[model samples]
Every structure is written in structure tokens, then in C-alpha cells.
Target: MNAKPRISILFVCLGNICRSPLAEGVFRSVVTEHGRAADFMIGSAGTGAWHVGNPPDPRSIDIARRFGVDISHQRARQVEAADFNRYDLLLGMDRNNVQTLRQRAAGGTLGKIHLFLDYANDRVIDIPDPYYGGEDGFASVYQMIREASEALLSKFD
Candidate 1:
């Protein structure tokens, strides 16, 4: 018998250390909670190269930990041309990140890229960048991602 194919997803943002890593962690937690973790492959990246090779921001890691998810292991990475082919879905945290991915995409690869909140049933259109903000900002971002992650996962059910 053949095994089912795993769906690959990549979350993206301006810098991988913040929103994208949180999104990755939240989504992973949701999937694992529902016993669907093995059915999917999840990861994250950024549109910029600044944070490459570093782990998720301390603030992001702390916020995720508060929610019982550990994102400390996730490292920053710049979105690459090859990623379009590697991931089935490439979710951007905001408009600028989506635009950057669109500009880098070749041909039909652009179709797989979308705003992370696009899957959300609510009216939230973008996941705000919380890099320059205080701890409360990270908390807000975590809530947004947690809600969207649940909505996004519901689509596959």
C-alpha cells in the first residue's frame, strides 16, 4: 500500500525571527494536537536575509512558550527560489512579504503564495510585524497566529 503524501507549508515574514517562526510553531502545535502532525511538513522563512542563521527572536520564543509551544529551535532563513517548488503552500505574514515572494516567483509558482491570514475566517487581513514593539506586541501576534492556524487547519479537515 502507498503512503499518503504530506502537505508542505512554509510561513514567511520580513524577518524569520518573528512572526513567521511563531506561525510555524503555532501551526505545528495545532496539527500535533489534532494528531495530524505526520500528515504535514511545516517550516518558515523570511523575505530578507538579515536574520539568516539565527534562531527565532527571544521575544517570539518566550511568547510561544507561554502558549505551551516551543519555537526556540526554529532558525531564520531567507526565502529562496527553490522554496516555491518545495512547499505546497507559502504563507506570507503581510502585504510586503507577499509582494516580495511574488516578485521572486517564476511563472505558476506565484499561485501557491498567499497571505497567512487569507485562511482565517475573520476579518484580519494581515499579521502585523511585532519586531520593534514590546512584549505585549508579541502576545498579540501569538493570538493572531493561533486563531489563523486553527482556521487554516480546518480547511484540510
Candidate 2:
């Protein structure tokens, strides 16, 4: 039997430590829960390099942990030009990040980049950054990412 091709996805944000990491973790958990872990490649990165070589923010780690997902081992990385060619989808947490990805991607790669929430919330096309907010903000962002993950997975599996 022939094996199915994987659906590779990369999540991006201003800083890799917050929204993008959470989206990566939540989407991984969703794929696993759906028994489709072997069907996908999931990762997170930042448009900016400020937090490269770091882990997700403490609050992001905590929020993911509370939901039974451990994201502590994931490191922050910068979005590189090669990423556009490697992943099937490059999703950004907000309009700015989406715009940045589109601008960085070559012409033919444009179709693969989009706002992360566009899969789940067409009206509020973003998963807000929780790095500067309190605990509640992380919680809300986690919920948003989780819902979007499910919605996005629906398209592939």
C-alpha cells in the first residue's frame, strides 16, 4: 500500500516564544489525539530574531502544561527563506506576521502562507500575543489555538 504524504505546517508570530509555540504544540496535540501524528510535520518560528535559541515563554509553557500538553522542549527559531519551501503551510498568528511571511516568500510560495486563525475564526483572524499580558491572556490564546488546530486538521484528515 502506498503511504499518504504528510501535511507539513509551520506556525509563526512576532516572537517564537508565545503564540506560535502554543499553536505548534496545540496542533501537534490535536493531530496526535486524532491519530494522525504520522500524517503531519508541525513547527513554530518567529518573523523576528529576538528570541532565537530560547524556549516558549514561561506562561505559554504553563498554559500548555495545564492542558496536558508539554511544550517545554520546543525552542524558538527564526523563520528562514527555506521554510517556505519545506512546509506545506506557513501560518501566522496575526495580520502582520502573515504579511511578513508573504513578503518573504517567493511569488509561487505565496499560497501557502496565511493567518493562523483564518481556519477557525474568519472574523478575528488572529491569535493574540500573550507575552505582554497577564495569565488570563495566555488562557484565552491557548483556547483560540486549540480550536483553530481542530478546524485546520479537519481540512487534511
Candidate 3:
């Protein structure tokens, strides 16, 4: 196998308790399933500090667990300036989150900031925020992130 790229990805949402943690968990699972766990470093954070140090929402954990990905251990945290340096890609769940990311993405890191769906292009796309809806919402979010992650991994590999 080709040596894996030393890539780091940071998933961001408004509150780390929902979308971002799920993205981290889902993306990590994808890399692990392909035996490329050591190829990348995956992490997540919220643009807001409201849920700092808190575990993902119970709804998120339950939904992720049902899909065979455990997100319970992940704690919510606010994005820091250093993350712009730490990650190769700083992907946001949506456009609004992109605005938040841009504020913290000082220096030349703006090039790394992108909408999560941007990678998927016309295929499976748009990492949605499932905070306001039902179980189906979480499932939809997970599916989108999974598909996008797959598309992204293909490019890197």
C-alpha cells in the first residue's frame, strides 16, 4: 500500500454535541474499516463554546450506536486558533458554520476551510445538523457524512 498521507481533518458545527462529533466518529470508522487509521488524524469541535467538555447529545450517541459507530467518548469543545494549523482540512457542516470557521481561521488557513458537502460535489452530500429533529434526521446526517468521507478518502488515496 502507498504510505498514507499525513492528513488531519477537523469537522465543525455550531455545537460540538451533535453534528461535529458524529462526523468525527463516522469518518474515523471509515478510515479504520479501510485499515488506514494511522494515515489520518480526525477530530471535531464546535464554532461555539456552549457545550465545551460535554459529551455528544444522547440522541446523537443513540443514533450512532444503532449504526455501529460509538461516539459516546467524544467530548464537545470549541474550535481554537491552533486548530487552523493542526488540521489539513477544516470542514464545516454548513455555510453558517463556514462563516464561524473563517473568523478563527487566521493566517492562510482559509484555503483549508470548506463545506463538508463540497467534497461530494454532485454525489452524496451536505452534512446536515440534526439537532432540531427526530431519529431519522440523525440517520440522514450520518449517511451524508459517510458518503462524503468515502468520496474524500478516495481522492487522498
List the candidates' TM-scores in order: 0.95, 0.95, 0.92
Model 3: weakest 10-residue lDDT segment is 119-128
TM-score of predicted model 2? 0.95
Number of residue pairs clashing in candidate 1, backbone atoms closer than 3 angstroms, sequence gap of 3 or more or interchain:
0
lDDT of 3: 0.87
Between candidates 2 and 3, the one scoring higher on TM-score is 2
Residue-wise lDDT of candidate 1 within 9-105, one digit each (tens)?
A: 9999998999999999999999999989888889999999999999999999999999899988888999988999999999999989989999999
- What overall lDDT goes with each candidate model? 0.90, 0.90, 0.87
- Which regions in candidate 3 have their CA more than 4 angstroms from the true location? 1-5, 122-126
What stretches of model 2 exceed 4 Å from their correct place? 1-5
TM-score of 1: 0.95
Residue-wise C-alpha lDDT for candidate 3, range 81-141, written one tens digit per residue = 8999989999888888988898777869899998888854544245667888998898888
Question: What are the clash counts of all predictions, listed in order?
Answer: 0, 0, 0
